[model samples]
Target: MALAHRILTIRRDPHSGEVLARGGDPEAHSLLERSGFVPVVRRHETYHRLPTGLDQDEEIRLATRAVARLQTVGYDLDTDPVFATERREPHYLSLGDQVRHLAVRIREAESTEEVADALTELTATHDGILAALTKVLHTAADFLQDLGHPADPHTAARLRHLADERLHVLASDLRHVRNDLADRQAVHPHRAPCPQEVAGDEREKSASCPCPAPARIPTTPSAPAAAPPAPAGRRR
Candidate 1:
């Protein structure tokens, strides 16, 4: 989906005024040109920065508040995926944080395009996590089965239970994101391309050339991938 509003994160050093992170779409660039937010342009867009001597935390807080103000006035600001912090390092991201990020993006998305983007991101992330969790459950279940007469049976059981619970929660999140995407798509479906019109505006080109109509692909639901079977001794 093409972003209609260009939202970008403006990261700069607190004292040097050096740009730490700066990137925005053309639409956002245009909007910024007309808005009161004055960005200092240096060598190029990459060097554009808002000089401030405030602390990093204070800078981020002010930036977020500025974004919030724009959002209230119907401006779609790109902050998610890079909100405040540049990266969460994945290793430290909890399951709850993952879900919360998706929920916040979905809630803040003001257009069908943004919603679709959010849904796609959520689906990909959720599926990977779900698969990993399922693998953990399967591995733990098998281990428990192999150590039929071993000590510390409770440890394996707890692992399996935790994986199962997390998987269920992730699945629910997947469903919610899918629903949100469907609703947004229904409300603002993509406009089909008019081949002839798109081909050319000149009379001569329209008469001499021909373009094939784009094919419509049919969508069908397939059976969900089966989770690895629990060990024979355990309940699925």
Candidate 2:
């Protein structure tokens, strides 16, 4: 990330008197939210603020903790005096960081089988990522279904819609793709492995191997010219 993106400012908003944290990347935002700050999202910016009704002592404590969390992970923070802390909080791998490894595996894959292996973690029958996510959503919905809020039923239904209609559809589609690639055993066209042996009828005995040239970078296609207007229609 850019150095600018790693910088944050935490101070009380002069007008609203709310302890607000501004600037930084999504990781910084995650840290602030994890420290009990609520996110305030706008069209052009997103920031974090201490939750409403917090006593001054609790707000300062939370802000100090947030500063420490950011500093330990290499973020630079400009904070109010009360929120300053020399201590650093230990950072650990978040579930999101673990999930990001799947993308890395897919990106480095050179064959259909390799890709399928990476996707299998997400599409496996009972214990897969999507399956677990669906279960979590359903359970959350069940909890909300009995809540006393007027919107509770609608929120519960929405969760069920997401778990069943949206996530289930996605899981089914990916499972289909994974099954198709299970036995493909096909190497990427542009990523063939070295044969390591020369052909018996080689034309050049001195040649090391008969590998194809590297793949070319595709050029961006230009827009087509606009067609000429048709001639005026004839009168009856």
Candidate 3:
């Protein structure tokens, strides 16, 4: 039910005069973030706002682009006049979506070796995703450490700590697990790779060839309604 009804409102706050966008699905939120809006994640709901200190024209451009992109993906937007646009900008896949395919591969794999191969793509030392993420964190930390803001130094330190400690441990553990899986050459008992071809003795061509359906639990059938009672006056 989570992204069932995608709707949003883009307008300047009545009191603060800051451009704000609220009430959207995750896809709409991602579009706003790509369009240069900052997300304000609250306990119950999340919303986006134009980052502070932008010129009015720049703010309008970002807001209008967000509206266009969200609308292009079929979101219903209630927008202010300045933020409304007739444009329906073409959408592109985000980098995060591309990276998520690794998880899909692992899920669909029928053997430990296949899973290990997918994990190698993530834990590979040279250009793996974790390596790239470590670089991004360090790059951000270096930029923020000397920004002259009082809180920025601590924020940068937190990022450095995460990259140096938590992420390193995770990558190391995953590397170990991947190596172990790579050594195992057995297929999963509950899963097998389908050949995607019909066997010579197959009876029904339209039915599943070699793949078997997942086992299902038996459900109790409801009792049939009792037959209507015979008319007592006529029969008895």
Q: Quick one: best lDDT, which candidate? A: 2
lDDT of each: 0.54, 0.92, 0.88
Question: RMSD of each candidate?
Answer: 29.9, 16.3, 9.4
Question: How do these models rank on lDDT, best leading?
Answer: 2, 3, 1
Query: Per-residue lDDT of 139-231 in model 1, one digit per residue for the tens?
Result: 977788668666547777777777678676876787577667667554332333334543446657436424465688988989999999877
Counted clashes in each candidate structure? 1, 0, 0
Angstrom error of the Cα, residue 131, model 3: value is 0.6
* RMSD in Å for model 1: 29.9
- For model 3, residues 1-236, the per-residue Cα lDDT tens digits are 35644878999999998999998777777888999999998999777889999999999999999988989988888999988888998877778988888899988889999999999988999999898889899999999999999999999999999999999999999999999999998798667766666767877868665566568998999999999998778655
Q: Which segments of model 2 are wrong by more than 4 Å? A: 196-236
Which candidate achieves the best TM-score against the true structure? 2
Residue 173 lDDT in candidate 1? 81
Clashing pairs in 3: none
lDDT of 1 at 205: 42
What would the TM-scores of all predictions be? Answer: 0.27, 0.80, 0.78
